[model samples]
Target: MSSLEKLTVDKRTLKRIIRELKKWKAPATVLLSLYIPPGRPISDVASLLRTEYSITDNIKLKRTRDAVQRALSSAMDRLSRMQKVPPNGLVLFCGEDMETHDFICLMFSPPEPVPVFFYRTDKWFHTEFLEEMVEHEETFGLVIVERDQATIGLLKGSRIQVLEELEGYVPGKHHKGGQSQRRFDRQIEQFVKGFYKEVAEAMNKHFLPLIEKNALKAIIVGGPGYAKQDFLEEAKEFLDYRIRQKIASELIDVAYQGPAGLRELSIKASDIIAKNKYAELVKAIEEFKRHLVRDDGLAVYGDKMVRQALEMGALKFIILDEDREDAEALAEEAKKYGTEVYFLSDGVPEAEWIKKTFKGLVGVLRFKIA
Candidate 1:
């Protein structure tokens, strides 16, 4: 929900693909090969648009292994030139090792890049056939600002998070409405202060259940008016440190509910965020640099810090900017170990919505924070 998504294919395209995949009622077994080729092909590199091709024919998934390999080789040859590979370069395997079921052929060509579904890879989603499987309920979140509101779309691997809206009380609502020169008595002013404080206290009470359930991940502060400001001042003592940090940006919009304001907030959530692996990690390090007040080298940069995080268990979590480029190694490394990851971009309606829903993006830490 916090950036890391692109609506590349329109609804029509998606509908068409869905229809086609439905028509593809094969045995659910597909051809698969790791064709090594005749001697590792003495070429520098080849631009065979890499992808997982799911070809279905009137043939058996297992039997077509050889023919599929040969066809792939042919396709590769037509696209790029190569030297010598092995006589029987590729090997055949079965089961989970072969993710392609009902496969006619599958290859990891780098040329044709199909966005593989890696659930939670960016935000929330895994690359799997959702057709036969029941679709899980998405973690929908909402954020309300004074002027606007927003709603978040659950992505690949998003957990069931909470969406909360805290409304602060403004005291003058119950008083006389006309142009009566009204001056508040000391008792009345005291009552107003108590009223505002009570409102804040009530909000805390409301969130107690959610916190107990741990259904929230982040909280976004937004609205057209000063509700967020008033709430922050009143609830400062009860606020989480990470969430306090997440309150840096203020919304200039107006809305009655968080979901209403989420739409406008998303527009401001797009900048300086990345979704791609190394780029996302690197961008976080860069932003992390700004938060370093003492700069005692505890706050550092480059692959060095990342490597340390990966090794010394310093990476409690990784923040990715939504505008990231390609990098597999860093993502893979994170998965190899147990580390939390998030992707965020500015100017997206869901960005603020996500923070509001989850309470803010802080995770279990591997090391102490400064």
Candidate 2:
């Protein structure tokens, strides 16, 4: 499957977390902390918080170590009591407080040959971990994040990992303003095509290995000015269906710096999935399938069947065709039971609605899947 094809959050793993987040009393507080042998420096935790997190003053640990200790106590107590943690919110932990033996991190290398990493909060220490992991989208289960220009990984309970890092190679001319230069400025234009050629070569080299690991998803060419465009055209002939349509390949503009390239690539990745719309269809199809096979809070088509499912409390989600005028009656019924309804319109492109119901079909469910 393509990278876009595998972006689903496993419902079985997330159901409990969803349930608890919904049932927990209002004014809910999210707890972020670190678990140590109980003797690690509180400043380690404090500096970790000071660097990136911003909560209310009541949550700060600057002058008062006890404040940090108290928050840790509360979060752990809540974590242990609960069977699961919600994905909708984030909780941070660091230093000794984060060293729980069970902590695990989930890291994706986009290929198997590249090492896969996750965080082990209980076993190790890192300050900015949780923030980085969440950037990968919802495929990961419960965890904290950690990444910077050099590192990217997560801590589910405590899985440590370091993703493969490839620097963006630049020939001398690539850093300058592309190929725009005059004979008087010939020294600056000395390395025009060669610059992008090197970038293109490096990119091809970086992404080609994924096929060996069955992980090649797409090739994106990006850098400012003429460099990316030049590279794109140079690399155009090679975007075979395997990499273009099948692997989600593309060539676009992005910063030449390694870190900036990744951020821009992430945004482009999100756009590729979002603008394409097929990803949503694929997910909706799987969600419906889950409903059919596992009774995981979904019902489909017809008023009687939907209500039967809802009354059985078997349904947590409702899918409706916007074109169905009679939808009003069914919508009212589904809403009465706290069912979440999403419009599946026939007027929209059929490709978009293929996974959802149309022609008066509807889905009813018992819970929400994010």
Candidate 3:
């Protein structure tokens, strides 16, 4: 399948571009944003820009007219070099930096296909379409159930949202007499069944809409001991068939039952979450850790060492905590060497660890620089 159909665009690069473009602005409506979807004829866009350049002469302010014409010229010049639209399409943002008053033009193929053709001139670069590409619209349903308590949550992007919490009462095993003990056991079983049913009802209520929207990717069910197993068994009857079908084949064993259990379930279900952006970030951090533990020359951390490696063209991949003041500068420098760059979000434990231990910047070297 094409990258557009799979929706697999390099999100890290897209985010970096978005962050960079958002900073450029003009005092007047002189900033130009153009989006050309795949299959568009570059010549058509060039002709349109030429017409726009001609129309700029009618502007009341000379400065605004000059800025608008310059931005349009920059865009047209960019399109002239492109033989055709890229697989994912192209985006161009050209304007005057309000602070520096320097002409600025940024162009790239977005990670995802531009859904429509658009062109606009505004004070700020149009980023709404790019923002949509980064939104975590798809979600995973999290259900952690045990005998006494259960928690249902949703893992959308990096955030986990608790949807419902339920509590139940099931008496422990009885030893009073044979008949009395048997009756107590049956009562306990019934209570457990009722709890499972309650959990299922909540799931159906919350997840059915997501399923219908095709936004629910999967459901992960977990808890301590046989309770999880029992739920899966009873799921055939208690859970909606749609939810039951969505349940991941791998059920996790978690010690806690409430919000804590949901967190545990997310970590344990790494195999399932591997496709997620947060999971990918975790994996990258883990890889860096492995190289560090091995004491291999391939691993380097801290600003000084990472910069040295980048200068030598030996850096293969670099991870920078987004909170670091110099992250954008370091990322730009790394890009000069064609190195892969990843910016870790603040507040993530692994990201925080990198910030605290490695001073927020790290790199994996292409070769031993020493």
Candidate 4:
């Protein structure tokens, strides 16, 4: 058995999956969303997949049943032999045909647990939940700086997208005589000034637009020492006050300054990253709570209430705890009712509060649901 690193589904991944779903044309398809709890045995999920496959034989749709079964079997075999299932959970899609063994197997782990279930259908794959996951993602700009170099990137959920790298000249202070050293220092000061100017320009060009557009929530700056501080000071005049205010964290211990630096910065600023990622979800939960307190009938909670709102075509939006096993079904129903869905990640404090208070399901209604 081979273990694979579990990856969180990001915007790029979700977009690619959506493209694949749009292009997928098959006689039968099997879509399995399995929840792999942390520290739980993989055999449990594998056995469940096997049992679910066994029941697919009774599907009266003769033309597609066999193909669906083959796809399900392939999915089961793949799941059973895995040494590690994603700690978050896995969603696997398999397309099979009896005539040609050209099967399409696609698997990705969500950033949070998705509802665990299996569905064999000839229609297009269910992806509302994934779309919701992508919607809740908050993008942040990442900057890692050194005296002579800097790296800029975008962080959306668990994915790090490097955008640009900058390098400049900063002369060393090691001249022989005092006069010579003074001259050398003057030249170095000039170079550092020019370097900071270029850095400010890069920041304005690459990051400011996203901040202005509200696509990016915050910026995390990190570096080895005073370099980061110096760069921030120089760039401050160029960046809008609003954008500068979005600077959530500054790290002084990052030793690298390129792509590796961006990665290292991500690790060093994990707390800020998590906070940015869940900030929007937390805001949405807050709004839901406001509605609840006002008794405006604009919000509803609990599994039963949310499902009822969905059935009545009254849901404007649905917020679900990703850990809830029934979220997938409810999200699918919400989609049919033309309601948008958002998954509340457990990493956020408000999400845990919602789970404890509302049984992890909530809805904003288009109108009173009584």
For candidate 3, give the lDDT of residue 26: 73
lDDT of 2 by residue, 1-370 (tens): 6432242233232332233323322122322333222233434443443442333345544423333344444444433432222222223332222223122222111111112222221222233333233222222111111111111221121232323343332234333354553432464333443443443344345444543433333333344555544444554555443433433344445543444445544555556644433454445546776666676544465667766787765665666554454554565566566555554534345425443443446564554432
> How accurate locally is residue 358 in candidate 4, as Cα lDDT from 0 to 100?
85
Q: TM-score of every model?
A: 0.34, 0.36, 0.45, 0.50
C-alpha root-mean-square deviation, each candidate: 17.6, 15.7, 12.8, 14.3
Better of 3 and 4 by lDDT: 3
What is each predicted model's overall lDDT from 0 to 1?
Answer: 0.37, 0.39, 0.81, 0.71
Name the best candidate (by lDDT): 3
> Which residue runs of candidate 4 sit more than 4 Å off their true CA positions?
1-136, 174-180, 277-343, 347-370
Better of 2 and 3 by TM-score: 3
Tens digit of per-residue lDDT, candidate 1, span 178-279: 444244444444554454454444434544444344333334445556755654575566545543543335434445343334544444432311223235
lDDT of 2 at 305: 71
**Candidate 3 error regions (>4 Å):** 1-10, 132-138, 141-235, 238-354, 358-370
Q: What is the lDDT, from 0 to 100, of the residue 361 in candidate 3?
A: 87
> Where does candidate 1 stray beyond 4 Å?
1-162, 165-219, 267-280, 283-370
Displacement of the residue 193 alpha carbon in candidate 1, Å: 5.6
What is the Cα-based TM-score of model 4? 0.50
